[model samples]
Target: MRASPADIESICLSLPEVELGISWGDRPTYKVPRGAKGRGFLLYRAPGKTAIDPVSGDMFTDLLVIQVADEMTKRTLVQDPQSPFFTIDHFNGYNAVLVQESRLGELERDQLVEIIADAWATKAPPRLVREYFANR
Candidate 1:
């Protein structure tokens, strides 16, 4: 029941103006335009050598990096032991959290949907945000 890459892609693309791109020409990344700039809100990030996966004694191949509204939100999510969110030293003070693919089953689909929507809203332009909220 773990969330798959297909789930992430569909959710991200469902948001207005989100585009599929690659991180370093490999990992999938989802971004939204902010004025003339494109901002990435959700990205597929693999654990680096600095962050070892305790279960495999190696780096994790499927970590999802999701942008949050602020550091407080990031801290709150990662600090909750029941939450599947986590972070590494590389993301210290960053306004994002990492969720492993294997642990996605711990979250319901609606939970993932809400997270994706919130992540998009956080990176979207003010005009887009206004339109999105107005339509809701």
Candidate 2:
């Protein structure tokens, strides 16, 4: 039931018009095509100063940044103690959550899929969103 990086990539790319791009530090970012550029919905984060482990003071190397529909959703996810979703000060106002890949085992595969799909919907073109749901 645990999700892997491959599962994340597969679930993301399965959505309509999703594209893969390299982000800062050469991290893999998943986005939905919109116009001249795509809007990123998910990203594999490189270890940085802002997201260090409180216990070890070490940068987290396995972080995944997943976009949410809004700030409310971001707060809801990160506030839930049982949820694997979290956030750092760097994302104080951003509509996204950080999940360590190592902690992905806390979530079921279906949950992972749904999360990625929702992320896609938030950034996917409106026409694409309507069409995708209409066909489903």
Candidate 3:
């Protein structure tokens, strides 16, 4: 099951200045606008690490599952700049990252919500959310 696009939109709305976007695997993503740090919703994904871009305070994503932890060298699956594409972990690996652009979208709101919802269902933290949801 995939994430619903509307849920993706909801997540985006949860953040400030964040607009809906498509992720690497065509998953829903949020586009942070300039000045979002000042006005965008507060981010709580992962904290406490060497700041890579001090000016932005955004961590440079790497391949070691550090997108939620730390910065490390990473390989992107995205190839064509004209299209949404991205890959991770050598040529073929268990984990991968998708590249989606919030700047553009051909999908509709309802459709987006549905897709995002599905994606969120399988989102990582792996055994975390699933276990929590089950216990709930």
Candidate 4:
């Protein structure tokens, strides 16, 4: 089933104090402001079951090491007392949640199957992904 624009809007508004926008991928992304640098989050949408379907938003990611620009900042994120996801600074405050352990159950298997089909289509025609975004 195709997702309605209203469906997308509902998801964005459900987030707490979120600022949403369409990213380069032509999918929804969000910016969450925090008191400190690199304390942001991305409301990223990844490929879904259908070539046109998109996964729901319900995941968070910590920074990775390689993404850190300087040694001091890297140490700060890694050593932060309230650190959630280790190596979070590596993401530079930009990460997407396409997979997670749902309380409901394992990931929706159907969702994965459709995503692969869409990915294959993209590989077969690079412009297809871009066009998909444009349509969204």
Extract clashing residue pairs from model 4.
Answer: 30-43, 49-114, 62-88, 63-87, 63-88, 63-89, 63-90, 64-90, 64-91
TM-score list, all predictions: 0.87, 0.92, 0.27, 0.24
lDDT of 4 by residue, 55-116 (tens): 43423321111123344544554465543213322244532212221211222334323332
lDDT of 3 by residue, 21-127 (tens): 44344433343442332221112122225324345776534211112111221132234454333333332443323323331254455543433332333333445
Clash numbers, per candidate: 0, 0, 28, 9
- List ranges where model 3 is wrong by over 4 Å: 1-85, 89-92, 95-97, 123-136
What would the TM-score be for candidate 4 when compared with the true structure?
0.24
- For model 3, the local distance difference test gives 0.34
Q: 1-136, model 1: which lDDT tens digit per residue?
A: 4455468878888788889776645876788972347688998885589567878798988788999989988888899999999988988978889998878888877788888888999989989978987886
Clashes of 4: 9
Residue-level lDDT for 88 in candidate 2: 91
Task: Name the top lDDT candidate.
Answer: 2
Which stretch of 10 consecutive residues in model 4 shows the poorest summed lDDT? Answer: 95-104
Return the clash pairs for model 2, or none: none
Question: Tens-digit lDDT track for model 2 on 23-95?
Answer: 6658889988834578889998988889999889899999999999999989888889989899999998888
Candidate RMSDs in Å, in order, are: 2.3, 1.6, 12.9, 17.3
